[model samples]
Target: MPHYFLDYQDSFHDLVDVDGRELDNDEHAATAARSMLAGRACLEILRGADAVISVRVRRGPTPLFSVTLAITEDRFHLNG
Candidate 1:
């Protein structure tokens, strides 16, 4: 199986800090991460037939966060 990377903006960056409250607070970071992960999981399942997919969140140049899903196929074929 091939590996893929997903990049997205992080809205919780402000909430996550060295103070440890972000991790300790069940209603905050944990909840957000779970929701994001769940969405990614669903996408993976849907794309399983064609390719293996991975989802990741990353911060972009813009202020908003973007969610990226990468799909990698096992074989490569060039056809015009």
Candidate 2:
């Protein structure tokens, strides 16, 4: 297992995951990020927030992957 950081980003704020997460790889982290943002449980919490937000995955100081969710557009796209 490897440690990865999930940073939450939007126009209003940039939140860094100081604790991070231990996952198998970047793909798993990407899925987790998408799930976290798209899950029903998060709907109420994130409702009325930014239409587009991003989850950035980083291994220590190196960025491995990123996923952006467009709530208004109902789309999810991944980036590196």
Give all candidates' CA lDDT scores.
0.37, 0.75
- The alpha-carbon root-mean-square deviation between model 1 and the true structure, to one decimal in Å, is 12.5
Q: After superposition, how far is residue 13 of candidate 2 from its true place, in Å?
A: 2.2
List, residue by residue over 1-80, the lDDT tens digit for candidate 2: 99989888766668998999899987898888777656632663457554667878889989988877665535578896
In model 2, which residue pairs have backbone atoms overlapping below 3 Å? none
Off by over 4 Å in 1: 1-26, 49-80
10 residues in a row with least lDDT, candidate 2: 40-49
Tens-digit lDDT track for model 1 on 1-80? 21122232322222222222223332344344446656755665565544322223222222222333444447688999
Residue 24, model 1, lDDT: 32
